[model samples]
Target: MTEIKRPTWAISNPLMQQYYDTQWGIELHDERALFEMLCLETYQAGLSWQTVLNKRSAFEDAFHHYEIEQVAQMTETQIAPQLKNEKIIRNRLKLNATVNNARTIVKLHVAGRTFDDYIWQFVDYQPQRLVIQKDENLPAQTRLSVQVSKQMKKDGFKFVGPVTIYSYLLAVGVVNARLD
Candidate 1:
């Protein structure tokens, strides 16, 4: 029997290994999960995904398990306390953006759309699966990510630049990662 070793980025420990093997690159249709990923990705700016993954549980707890409605209604002062908690990323901008982004999601819901609907629209509501010949060659930003990031910003989302959106798209499986 042979053991399948994961990529270094994916197998530093149990949590990352589990997340990479079970969830990474899998299409996520749930609105709440999509929202959560968006917030996490925003927090992941300039940081390693493993750092964010390690704090995922604390983040979930701080953000009320990312309950869209609950987080949507959280005020800055309400979330400010989290800055002092060492369990999660403590950046003020990212934390505020998380709440603000939740509000945007709720607004979309009011408009009769879910975050899931809004995001998948960029890809025509289908996952853009790609064959990966070389993992290192995967682009930092793509045309689709650019278009989606522009639209999202116009629609009032924060922390959603092209690079971040590209990462977000990949996380939620709008873009499939078949790295070889």
Candidate 2:
């Protein structure tokens, strides 16, 4: 067997490396997965990716396994105590955004659109692959991300901005930056 070396930004842990290699650049179509990724990415604001990755399972449990309907219906009274939970990010704004984003996810579903569909449409259902030699080459925001952020805000989504949207796009595989 031969060993393969990945880029420096990928954690040395085998599982994290596998996730970065296999899933990070591949386009995802599942609505539930899209919702989960969006929520996680939003919560990732101002936090290290490793922190979110480490607590992903806890987040899944806390957010009802990322079930849109359940999270959508969570009231402040119901979600307030989660801030005390050591499992997930304790930021009030981020927690509230998760609930709010869930409602928006459901609204999109009710409009006969899946979160995957709505999000992927911004890229014309194509992954924007970029050739890069280093992590620093990756952009923090793009015109597409800005447009998407504006539209999402107009649609009443929170915790969304150009930078955040760009992160979401990268996380969900709308953008693939691979050095080739």
Candidate 1 stretches with Cα past 4 Å from truth are 1-8
Worst-scoring 10-residue span by lDDT in model 2 = 1-10
Q: Mind sharing the TM-score for model 1?
A: 0.92
lDDT of 1 by residue, 1-180 (tens): 545445566667888888877777789999889989999999899999889998999999999999999998898788879999999999998998888888888889899988888999888988998776433466789999999999998998999999999998988889988454
Worst 10 residues of 1 by lDDT: 1-10
Number of clashes in model 1?
A: 0
User: 1-180, model 2: which lDDT tens digit per residue?
Assistant: 545445676766766787687766567888778888888888888887778888889999989988999999999998988999998899999999999999998898899988888888888988988667754557889998999999999998999989988988887789877545
TM-score of each: 0.92, 0.92
Off by over 4 Å in 2: 1-5, 134-136
